[model samples]
Target: MSIWWSLHLRREAASVPLARRLLLGTMETAGVDPDISFDLSVALSEACANAVEHGGDERAGVSSSAEYRVTAYLDGETCRIEVTDSGPGFPVVRGRRGALRSVHSTAEDGRGLGLIEQLADHVHYRNRPGRGAVVSFDKILKWREGALLKVS
Candidate 1:
């Protein structure tokens, strides 16, 4: 069975875990392996945390209407997730590996992007300047039946 879900969440710290829990439950119900599920959960948490912390207007606090969106798609063999925020777009730098890099080792506040990259098989970042930013990643899924597949 294929599964997909999208969540429109307020830009608040409390909403991070709510998104993570929903993703985890969905994966578990789909018979996703625990290790893969755990990795995706951590990556999702980091993405959600980044959205809550950076996906907002220049104002000092999030307004009641401020929101971010998280979407997940699982088609039995692969899982893809995208997190879109309403805040100002972030800077993007290409790392030596040609992957999108958004963190500095010495910076204490921006480790989420790095963690997401390490955990997910593929990562992409798009900055919309005045519009907003999008962070997307996908991982190949393995089932207990020894069926190997790729997202197409």
Candidate 2:
């Protein structure tokens, strides 16, 4: 059974907790491991927070976006989450291995993204071409005994 959900939310601070609660509720109902649930929820919150804070701005005398999007998918043994915003997009940076590296600054914001890296199995950061930035991540799921996704 695959579970998926999406939210188009106003870019407000309150939206962070709202997204987190929904993800947590879904995780609980699916009997996901508490630790994993916590990690995912934290990651979701950080992504949402970034969207709320930096997802939009007054550019070229234009008004900023009032909203952003969050999506989640749970299939088989993996759970994927994405937060997309209409902000300027991620700063371009490459690591020694030629992979996109998270912001490596002392700012708290950078740490939040770095935290997401520490918690998730795989993550993708990209832009939507015409005008948006997307931060998508996934984790390997571990089910509790009575998990809805559990196979006997």
Candidate 3:
């Protein structure tokens, strides 16, 4: 079975937990391995936190009601999530292989992206043309032996 859900949340601290809880509940109901679910949930929380903190485009006269979109998809043996915001898109700097961005140990911010990369099997950071930033990630899922929503 496949499941999909989306939420339009105001860019606020409280919304972070709301999104994370929904994801955890969904994964729990689907019998995802506890460790795997926990990892994904952490990654999701980081993404949501980033959006809530930097998702506002005030320079562009965007509304005070800053908002972001969180979408989750569970299909087959994988789970994917995407968080999009309406802030000014981040710059793109490519390294030899891909964007070479490093977060320092003393950094108070920017650690979330690195944490997300570590937690998820695959992670993507990009900007929506003429819109804002998008952080999308996915992980290969491991289910409990008696998973209630096992996919064929």
Could you tally the backbone clashes for each prediction? 0, 0, 0
lDDT of 3 by residue, 1-152 (tens): 78899999988899999999999999999999999999999999999999998887888675743889999999889999999999876666666788735455478878998899999999888877778889999999999988876775
| Model 2: per-residue Cα lDDT over 1-152, one tens digit each | 88999999998899999999999999889988989999999999999998888888557233557889999998888899999998888887888877567886686567878889889999889876547789999999899997998655
Best by TM-score: 2
- Whichever of 1 and 3 has more TM-score, that candidate is 3
Q: After superposition, how far is residue 120 of candidate 1 from its true place, in Å?
A: 0.5
Instruction: Return the TM-score for each candidate structure.
Output: 0.85, 0.91, 0.90
Candidate 2: residue pairs that collide? none
Candidate 1 on 1-152: residue-level lDDT in tens? 58889999988899999999999888777777878989999999999899888888766355532899999999857899999997876766678986556878679877888899999999988887666789999998866443333233
Task: Give the poorly placed runs of model 2, Cα more than 4 Å off.
Answer: 60-64, 97-99
Q: Give the TM-score of candidate 2.
A: 0.91
In order, candidate lDDTs are: 0.84, 0.88, 0.88
In model 1, which residue pairs have backbone atoms overlapping below 3 Å?
A: none
